[model samples]
Target: MSSGFDPLHPRELDLPMAVPLRADGALVDVTSGEAALTMDDGKIFAAPSDPAQLDDWRAQLVSWREGARARHGVPRRYDDPASAWAARCFTVAQVWLWDELFFDFDAQRFTPERFLADARERFGGLDGIVLWHAYPVIGIDDRNQWDFYDVPGLKQAAAALREMGVAVFVDYNPWDTGTRRAGDDATELAATVRRLGADGIFLDTLKKADPEMVAALDAARPGIGLEGESKLATERIADHTLSWAQWFADSEVPGVLRAHWFERRHMQHHIRRWHRDHSEELRSAWLNGVGMMVWEVVFGVWVGWNDRDSATLRRMLPVQRGLHAWLVEGEWTPLAVHEASVFGSTFTHDGSTLLLLANTSDADVTYRPEGVGWQPLHAGDTADLITVPARGIAAAMQVTGTEPAELDAVRTALAAETPARDASFPHRRTRRLAPQIPSRAQLAPADIRAGATVRTVIVPSGEHVLTVRHRARETGMYDGAPYVDEWKPLPPRLHDQRTLERVVRLANPVRVGVAEVSAAEYALFLDAIGEQAASRDPERPASGVTLARAREYAAWVGGRLPSEDEWQLAAVQPGFRRRVPEVWNWTESEHSDGRTRFVMLKGGSAHESTGSDWYVDGGVRGPEFALKFLLPGLGQDASPSIGFRVCWEETT
Candidate 1:
């Protein structure tokens, strides 16, 4: 009478399976649950990894599949090769469109033909693409609305893409489970996949997918690729899953690489999302052996795809093409090389090994395998030491066993280099000059004596455009030595020493503070707001405050944080003192290194050279960018030597 099947003690199968049955009607032998059994679908069915569990989870799965056939009359299992889908998804890209933002009904914009052409041209060579929230036309405005079931031309577009040898995958939401068979969400989804001729579907926000649904979907179209949103395939429902190796900035890679070592080879991992930084683009692909999915704003998105970033990615196509098998299916071994700051991994395929090293610290790092005669391979160059610049990478292939001559060369090169130092200050310790004149730190709202010398610089309003040249070199590598060949601006950062002209339209003149907000001045604002203030040294710049808190202080002083343009304009004005106490200053604009939100910090600090650290986008609000340590009991372990400078719109 009970419908639920117990995983511990699977009941005997009284009836035969509906279809695709084995010749012997081979059922799951519950007695041999401890033994590993290969399923008809080429998936290994075994007991859970934990030793305490008495029942085999895989046997329970076999019993559950049979029960579904008796209850729902549909067979989801098949003898298809599991790696078929992953092999097809070698180079995947993502596509989507917004409502009316980049489209015009009259002009007939964002047509399927146009989108496909642009994607082909932009992505260069893509095997598959995952369509996200892509409706035929921008009919609805709500982003949360799925609107997939009734979208016009959804099937036609999918079929067209499939015709071009590109696999088409549509988004599916499994949480919309319903009770009735007619209204069953899985049934509808299965029908949609068939109707649209879609090759696969991406299940969003699901830790595990329902087996019945996965079965029904397979029954509709055999061997269809099922992709999960999460990096881990907790439930064996998907062929491959989206691996966010670079999500939260550089936080996810190590754990992801470790997980890849244990997971099934057929179950592939693909890096779907990343920050604007292109430095990690190739590094992630080579290190993790995962594919990259680039989302170009073909039509609808807040930010369109940068052509410059695309060109940078295109350069790596040759490497990806050559190492397809090794990069896609090779076994990953996380390496512990000499440098503690440098992270290393090796991908081995058929006795051939490729080493990947990434430098997280802000300094050049040297690494050599213990006993492998691996020459640093970069378009065929001989190097004694494999040096990776700050926030850079180095890769090489194992050519032969370690030779004493090769090892000696590496050792000699490393010995000749200067001893590694902390990345913060490269050359020498900086000294701070005491402020001779009184600053905002020493004054309060009531202490405003007329003619107190509150120096302010005025920036005239107008249409201003300027071209600036910036190199893609690391912070401490301003001289551009060994990395000169590797130095090139990717994305999110400017192209290597490339000149870019930007236009800024200012409607009115604005007055900006001559110096950064002092610790004493920030204390008055904190007290007025009934919050405890940190150190109250009038001469020191405010140190213990977040970007949001800095904005509050700026507001309390009858001004606001300046935009990147505003900050730059104000600092360039005549009579604008670059430094008083010398601290990093926060701006209103925001930039992200993928994990943390950072406001630009500018102005020379006590620990840096006199003219250094002065600019619009100065310091990130992260411990990695801190120039000095803050006083104890500040609630945070380390705070960047940073403060805020306020700016007001001039009405005169």
Candidate 2:
């Protein structure tokens, strides 16, 4: 359509949208590994390999970061400088207990002592605890109601924990779900902090909580710390907030690390050490230099933490404590670990540098730190290598005030006693490659008449190379494409990375359902298969169905589960675009790790950004807001919200 369009180019794309182009006319394929910028003339621009080249690239990134900060009006310094420094010095964990566990109907069984004791044993030591929803009745004026700490000996127990150097923080839900007003909440916050001797308050779901409220509380308490629930709080209001590795399921190494690179340095960020593998949690913390909130179980959301999980914490606590000054308020720099699937970062405080490494692979990885001549760290426990076992950690302090040999000895003994484990896999899921699409031979578009409930659309296929525009990063480009010269044993799993434009070749033209499969249709399939359910409402999108059942329903309708690529092609291929429901649609794709099969769920319509085809897995019930969820099983696992639609492959 433009003068740059070369129809005869080898990788020419004839899709509808404009492909993102580099300054030199190269196309940007953010998801490709070899080269993000591919010229129409066949040249490739990859990452710089040499030191001089690398430095030039990093310089460019610094300039870009500074420009962004200026454009966004992000202040160079925190308003409360003392509080900001304090946030870096300490880490935080959370404890959520409902009436069942915290109190129960019977007051006699309230054992605050046992709860605190178990927390100490599991967590080893805690700098702060975010006691969520531990209030009386989720509001302020109802302080007369049986509060979480209202039981007999609870006040003394809280005092005992505070004495052990564990700063206690209580929840202050500003919205209070319409239970209390802002003025009332402010009064209760100050009163609770004094009554419980709390060091601060965790403002949960803090959209409505005005920054003035925080300032007021701080003025009243003089030195109270406040934590917001979201990472967005870093933009303005909160002193601290939880910032997890917000990755799509099936993310690769260094997953979501780049997103927080600059922001983590300026804010008191922390992540809940839940769902993801223990080693990953530690690595994420190390790379981003954020605090970890040790939350193993809250309500029925179990992270399946064990003794090894506890050991993992014990191994890092002292090292983190020893290097608190540097690890918290230091400049965080990422390092490339050679010869292993390793993710690590260096924290420079004063003159000392602490290099923290998390080996995510199965075997032992030998890390030779670049620039410095420190002895190579072995895969296991050793004098130089503070081995963290497999899928564990190893920290080496260089030129620090602390003795390296003593620190290594203590870490080695801990690693030796700790049980070795393979890296734990998260239940979340997504796609790596853009789904394969229809070939040019399959290009056939026609207006088709359909029944009332079964609307359909036809797509014409042609040559398309999936492309996405990406932002520049210190590592070159923050694109979904893997690193230059990166190889993988298995194909990638997710592709919902941010994009300016993405183009994929589509060759197989198929007819897809105008909408997601409906409850009426699912009911018919169930009845046809002699299966019965409790309720069957025909108009609503079918939900609470399994992959196998979805497949059966598709088959009944003379279609099949659409491949990941086909689903996308059908959804956005020009004239084929049709409105779909705000639900997660199950694709035919299945993910396996040699032992378990995880079904793929795509397109988070309600919770995620609209029009983006984000992916979440069907196993382990997704977050509370997830309307579609799956469990760990071989397609038999069924839950509410997860459903599927039908698509038929046609040879025209």
Candidate 3:
């Protein structure tokens, strides 16, 4: 029904027809390589020598007009194919034909029938079949590349495909050492395609000279196909030249088709390099006029030789499916571009919008969709912040008027539909962090060191309480030397050798309100802490304690740390941000040097004169006295400013 025409018939008897009108009300044959209609009634028409194509132009116009009228609910305008056939034909807008034809010039061996048979058998079921010409003559000189033209077998293949109810398209390139010269006359090349009974030509490596060449080619054969190579932009073709070539070819000739405008490259690299910058422009070309074709799902020369494995295939499926739905099935509309710190692409369709977030980083990225409710199609969970793995992609479809309840339902549906993938790290233990306190047995020994700030370690087996400790150095008057200064002596020397008793205890339990907090609240909490610290009196050891007390505070806070799962949950809090400082927390961890002991600092240090504040500001300070703890279940890395917050649970 969408195409408004059947394709099974060898030729149409009652072809729907229309007389295209210019803004000035003059009749224009759209199929002819001639007139173009401008918005302001201005007409730019090219006069071609062969005007006989005018009839074909008129017939196509009538068909388009009837199709449009039917779409608008008009009835009985003309006899049309049944709805089923029309819909089937339209659904298959394009097809790809494998180049299996063999040409032997020495023996003059040519078989059109065999080629036709193979075309129908291989690609007959598709809507339209695109035939790739002879094998790429890799080492052949440009002058002799077109020598295939003189070969009898090549011509037979083209004719056979056309006769077998298949449209034939040939590949032409501007590369050097090929059939055509780099600066060959465009008009002459156009004549060859027109005379060869070819339906269209796929332009390869079209440069700045290509548009004019295509225009000249159109003049020779009004409806001859005029496609461009993907590298035209690389060669610095003017924007106007590229757009004008497409516009002229599309408006003037019915057979003008553009294929492979977006070159095929690795899906991963493509997203990393070009998707953000070029997706919009490529999308515009598809909507503008010319039919767009994506070349390959995966990159490899031979069929099935370098086929994508299931893993890569699965990753790319959402993108390919999403794009197809937007460009072909769904109503076409304009979409604004969104730039994410991670990976994502967005487009609108039929009043609903689609946001695709792909995690290409080594660590997982927490995504929160803005201005809309989103449900993860892959996770089957509903939440404001969803974690996507590195190199993983998630698609979220948001429709207008979707209420919160409806959104939740959609999320549930998608989750149920998606099959979970197996993700295992052989080197480390992993656990999903949630609201409940994780059992001590689930915590793992993670190495913590300078520069190795964040890590995801597997929880080791067995019940164990982790004690973290920070390595301290003598400073100020002590100057890292043993007891020399009378003003400020080192803790070990200041106290009577045998009289001092060292004691440690957990601080008050922190109130847990929610699993995740908002960014604003997180920032505000940090700001509040800073203000409180600013108001503290620095004159007298600040109310709380002595040198021995300060050491105990640092030691107790610095000894134990939260697991990776715990850190993840805290980082993703819905609306609370807290500056983790005060007690230096220690993780059951190690240093990069393979040492068993390491420390993580939180809040600013008590020794201001020792340059602890300077070190923290300069990012040289480790989790010392003041630190915030994050949930490891959320995924850990060194990208964010992370310290630690300690917790003590009674051991049975």
lDDT of each: 0.46, 0.47, 0.31
Query: Which parts of model 3 have CA positions greater than 4 angstroms off?
Result: 1-143, 149-169, 173-188, 195-202, 219-341, 362-392, 401-652
Give the least accurate 10-residue stretch of model 1, judged by summed lDDT.
626-635
RMSD per candidate (Å) reads 21.4, 18.1, 29.0
Report the Cα lDDT for candidate 1: 0.46
Query: Which candidate, 2 or 3, would have the higher TM-score against the true structure?
Result: 2
lDDT of 2 at 189: 72
Candidate 2 TM-score over all chains jointly: 0.49
Give per-residue lDDT, candidate 3, residue 493: 36
Residue-level lDDT of model 1, residues 465-498, one tens digit each, is 7543333322311111212112221333422334
Across 336-394, the per-residue lDDT of candidate 2 in tens digits comes to: 44234666667777766677777777665655555543432223444344454566677
- Runs in model 1 lying further than 4 Å from the true structure: 1-79, 87-91, 97-124, 134-153, 175-182, 231-259, 264-274, 278-285, 296-300, 303-318, 328-331, 336-341, 361-377, 383-394, 400-652
Best by TM-score: 2
lDDT of 2 at 234: 21
lDDT winner between 2 and 3, please give it.
Answer: 2
